[model samples]
Target: MSTYPHFGTDAIHAGQDPDQWSSKAVVPPIVMSATYKQRIPGQPDLYEYSRSDNPTRGVFERCIAALEGAKHGIAAGSGLGATTLLCQLLKSGDHVIAMDDCYGGTYRFFTAIMSKYGVEFDFIDLTDISLMEKTIKPNTKMIWAESLTNPTLKYTDIEAVVKLSKQNKDCIVVVDNTFMTPYFLRPLELGATIVYHSVTKYLNGHSDVVMGAICTNDDELGSKLKYFANACGIVPSPFDCFLANRGMKTLHVRMREHQKNATAVAQFLETSPFVEKVIYPGLPSHPQHELMKKQAKGFSGMVTFYIKGNLQKFFDAVKVFTLAESLGGFESLVEHPWSMTHASIPKEKREAIGVLDTLIRVSVGLEETEDLVADLEQALKASQ
Candidate 1:
C-alpha cells in the first residue's frame, strides 16, 4: 500500500505517476487526441472520447480532489459553467439561498437565467444566522456562498452553514472557494457538500486559462455531476487542464507570498488619509476577522477600501497596480467594484451591499511589500 503525502507533495506528485506512462516523463503528458483507440468493438480501455474524459484532465482533476480532500473532482469550461452544473441538480420550483454580496456573474446567472427556469433564488445577508434559518423553505435545495465574498471581504461561517444543511436534509451546501483556494481553506472537511473554484484565478495563478472545478466527497453526487459534465460537454481542453495542473503545483508558495503582500497592503491602506475604510479578513478591524481565523488557515490576497478623495485620481496615480478586472494573479491589480466586477448588479443593489463608487478592490501580488506600500503611498499623495 502507498502512503499519502503532505499537501505540497500531493500537489506535485498525486495523480502523476511517471511509471504509469510509457514515456516515463516526470510531468503529466497532455493527451490532445479527441478519441482513443479501442481494444475491442465496444470495449474502450480507460478513455474513449475526449468529451467524456482525457488523461491530462484526469490528472488535473485527481490532483485538485486530493488538494481539496475530496473523493471526486469535475472540471468545467469556466467558473460559471461549474455553477451551472450544480444548478442542474435542482429541478423546477427548487429554491436557492445565496449570499447577497456575491460575485456579479453568479448573481446575474441566478436572477436572470435560473429564475426563467422556475428556480427561485433569494439574495440575503448570510452572516445573520437567524436570517438564514428564517429564509429556509421546504423547497430549498442549495445554499450558495463564498468563503470570503468578493470586493468587500465578508467572511462566511462554513461550519455554521454546514450545520444548517444538516438540519435541512434536502439542502446541499456549495461554497465557492476560489478566493481562499485549498491552500488556505478546505470546505469539504468543514462539511460542505460541494466546493467549486474558478481556475482562472489563484488555482491557475496566471490569468491565462479560464476554467472551473467542482469537488465533492459524496459518491452519488460526484457520479451525477460527472455524467452531466460528459453529457453536456462542458469540460476544458487538454492543454488548459495541463496549464491549471502545472500552476497548482506552485500554489503553496504563491499563496504564502500573496498573503504576506496583502497584509502589508491592507495595513498601509488603513493608515492612509485618503482611505476611509480598509476591508480584509486578515485585518483585526474586519467584522468577521475572528470567524476567518476559525475557518481558514490564512487570508488570501484580496483587499478592498473606500477612498476619501477622488477615486479616478487614485486610479490614475497608481503606477504599479494595474487597473483591471479579476483577482488572484501574480501581478498586482486594482479595480473599481461598482464599475468593473459588480457592474452587472443594479446600482441600488450594489450600494445596498456597500459596493460604492469610491470602493477600490486590490489583488495584491507577489511583489515586495515595501515596494507595493511605496507605490500606494505615492498614489494616495498624488490623488490628494
Candidate 2:
C-alpha cells in the first residue's frame, strides 16, 4: 500500500503547519510578509520578495504538486496566465493539436491571439483517434485537452492521446484537469507530461479565490516554465493562495457530496418532460461514459442539459439556481453559455459546437438533492 492514506488524508495534511509560530493554531498561518530576512550577512533568505516567491505560496505549490503527483507546481494569477505560460514552451511555426470542444476562452486564446504570433493550431474531435493522427504535422509540439470538456461535458481518451504523443517526436502531452480536480483524477499519471488546474473553481470550492496552477514531473521543463512565470510576474497574491490552501482540505468530502447531488440531478433530468437531453459522464447515455470510468475515479460535479421549449423560460424560472458564469462552488449555479460565458465566440461557431440556446449548464452543489430536484421541478413547470 502507498505510505500515504488516499486523497482525503493528503488533502488535510500535505502542507506544513505553522505551529512553530503559534502553537494553538490548527491552520497554517498566512505568511503575509513581503520579504524574508537573510539569517546571516551572506546567507540566503527564506524568501527574498513576494512577487518571485512567498512562504504561503510555497505551501500552495507543494500541496498541489503532492496532490497531482508532480515534482513541481507553480501558481499563477489566473487560469489564463497558466495557459499563456504553457504556450511559451512552443515557438513560432510550431503546430498544436487541441480538442475541438474546450473552454471557449481557451479556444479564443489559442486560435485568435496565439495565431498572430505564428503558432499553428487545428481543432479536431479528440475522441476520434484517427482524426487526431491525420492532423499531426511535422512540427507539432503539443496535444492539449480538458479532461471533461466544458459546457458539453464531452471527454477525451487521455491515455490514447498520451500514446500518440509518445509516438511523435518532441511532442508533449498536456491536460487541463480542471473539471475533475486532482482528487478525482491525476492526469500526469495517465501519461500526460503536465496537468493544470484553474483553482478558481472546485479547488477553491467556496468561490473566493481565483488562481491557476501548472504542474509537471519533468524538472527541466518545470524550470523553464517557472522562469517564464517569474518573468511574466502574474503570480497570484499571498492571501488568495492561503484561501485556496484552506479550501483544498475539504475537497475530498466536498467532491463526494457534489458527485452524489449531481448524479441525482442528472437522473431527474433524464426522465423529465421538460428536459430534452442531459449531459454527464456518469450517465450511460453520455457518449464517453465508458472512457470516463477508465480515466476518472468518479464523475464530476458539472451537468449540462437542454430544457424543453424556449431557453428563456428555463433561465427565468429558476429561483434557487443563480444565473452565473462560473461553476464548482458549494452553491448551485446555472448558465446559458451561448449568451453568457461563451458569447465571445461567434454565433455560427457556438451553434456548431452544440451550445444551443436551450442548453443549461449546472454546477451542482452540496445542497440537499431533494431540494434541488424540487427547485428544478417547480422551475421547469412554472416556465412552461
lDDT winner: 1
Candidate 1 on 1-384: residue-level lDDT in tens? 665687889889889999978999899999999998997988899989999999999999999999999999999999999988888999899999999999999999998998999999999988888899999988899999998898788888889988986777889999999999999999998999999999999999999999999999999999999999998889999999999999999999999999999999999999898899999999999999988888889999999999888778888998889999988889999999898889999999999999998899999999889999999998888888
TM-score for each model? 0.98, 0.96
The local distance difference test score of each candidate is 0.92, 0.88
Name the TM-score of candidate 1: 0.98
Clashing pairs in 1: none
- What's the lDDT for residue 27 in model 1? 95
